[model samples]
Target: MTDKYSAGVLLFRRGDGGVEVLVGHMGGPYFARKDNGAWSIPKGEYEPELEDARAAASREFHEELGLFVPAGDWIPLGDVRYSSGKGKKNLIVWAVEGDLNPADVVPGTFEMEWPPRSGRMANFPEIDRADWFDLATAHDKLSTGQRPYLDRLNDYLTQTGE
Candidate 1:
């Protein structure tokens, strides 16, 4: 019923007359079998005490992508809201330009019990795999709630040439 606020970055790099954005496939057993519409930008929740959602966003990006993202001028592309009746989530978005290598990426891992009741624990990468996709493909691959960030980034680039 209430809205929860979160932050994420739309990392992009120039490529072959267009731009490619970095989108991460969520890890863990829940998302291991999923494909389209399951990936998302590196992001997470933060409390007001944190005071800097952009900083939190950058930190989450580094942790999830296993690379440092400089805290530079962030192009605020506003937010996207998604609700499932149980709760509403607001995603604050920003556009960042950077180069990232999927091969070199070593996402952080979490220990979880596999096979549900088997009680066997295994480590899963925080982000199973990351890839760069053009705006159209990214829109389809990203989570339903996060597609807006790509749209907004495209609009911003069209309007600002950045």
Candidate 2:
């Protein structure tokens, strides 16, 4: 068994429709045709010994979405652990208040052998699409492993009376 750790930020904003969050669809062939559980928070795994959780969250947010999580008080949503095949992935998420237009996003890209067994390599955006969705929509769109962040963020905000 292996252990994986990731850090990311959940950028939320208030609007007439209530709170909204910026999320992205997982790119690549595996998730290409899937919609329900294909989207995820903007995050990436990092070596825990090399960086603090919050700092890693900020870094990964920028790396995945090509934009910084706007400067603000980031409320720690704590950790979530989920099974990934024979490994476990633990994710630390922070809820930060921010607003950004999805149209302006410039997602980071990764190179991979698109057609398995073929030698051809191609570049694809890590997140092929991004958009702002209200909590309910986010819950429906985000992957099961990442959906807890939505509830955690709601709890934090409610407890703090934000």
Candidate 3:
């Protein structure tokens, strides 16, 4: 029952290989060398009391990837509750049909103390890279807690035939 809240948009597109989703590899030393489970939806923490979840999602998409959210209908994929190193977290996400070139990404960055305790501050991109992956691959790449949204998105697409 943590008070922290986050929201994100999962942009999907129909490709020759079938459905593909845009995901970003988390940056910083902790995930620099990691592959599976090191990627995430473009998202950020937000105060639920001050902003709508959908708005937060769109804002985070731009802030994280530096690209405007493509125009499309947003299908709510619902929320998931899970425990993180920061404690329990509640994340709400939506699936939108869209496409974009990964090379166009200009990721946002954050400054933090690096080397654990050297009292040195370093800047790192929030998302080092962005790319599209099939559902199976995305499942392996996305963080465990965020994986449920992919299932939800699949169910929605199946139901709507979209």
Candidate 4:
């Protein structure tokens, strides 16, 4: 099977004496009714020609969040396998320090049929909502495999005192 890959950013901010991370809720009909582990970091797939997955992650964030994230220092948190069994080689993860305003988010759009087989087209936001959550809460809200990215971030911060 061909290997698939995607990348995401774990954006964090120091607040209330701890770090809080920003996560996004997937949009569209399939994910609309789900919660508590349905949300994910803003990310997407790209061809090898793209080369830089980190740049793709940053671009995807802008497309999904409608904001510019300065290319500051990024800490590589390695990669993790998704549970979907899509032959994903791994999800390249990174820790980026930045501030995001959930209120300003204007997610990208996708075209899909509202009612199955109805053939009526509609647009849906790439992400329905985004929020900041503490690590524990994020663990429950994020995909099971993606949780390691959070732990890796904490480990990096602890080691570097960032």
TM-score of each model, in listed order: 0.87, 0.95, 0.97, 0.90
Span of ten consecutive residues with least summed lDDT in model 3: 1-10
Q: Arrange candidates by lDDT, highest first: which order?
A: 3, 2, 4, 1
lDDT of 2 by residue, 69-106 (tens): 89889888889999765589999999889888888888
Ranking by TM-score: 3, 2, 4, 1
Tens-place lDDT per residue, model 4, 34-111, is: 988789888777665756898888887788888766557788999887656576556887888888888888889889
Q: Please give the distance, in angstroms, between residue 96's alpha carbon in candidate 3 and its true position after superposition.
A: 0.9
TM-score-best of 3 and 4 = 3
Per-residue lDDT tens digits of candidate 1, residues 1-162?
Answer: 567777878889887859899889999888888888889898877774655888778877888888877446689988778963359887787888888788877898889889898999989998999999988888888888888888788888889866
Model 3 residue 58 lDDT score: 96
Q: What C-alpha lDDT does candidate 1 achieve relative to the native structure?
A: 0.83
Number of clashing pairs per prediction, in order: 0, 0, 0, 0
Selected candidate, larger lDDT, 1 vs 3: 3
Q: How many residue pairs of model 2 clash at the backbone?
A: 0
- What are the lDDT figures for the candidates, one per model? 0.83, 0.89, 0.94, 0.84
Best-performing candidate as measured by lDDT: 3
**Regions of candidate 3 where Cα sits further than 4 Å from its true position:** none
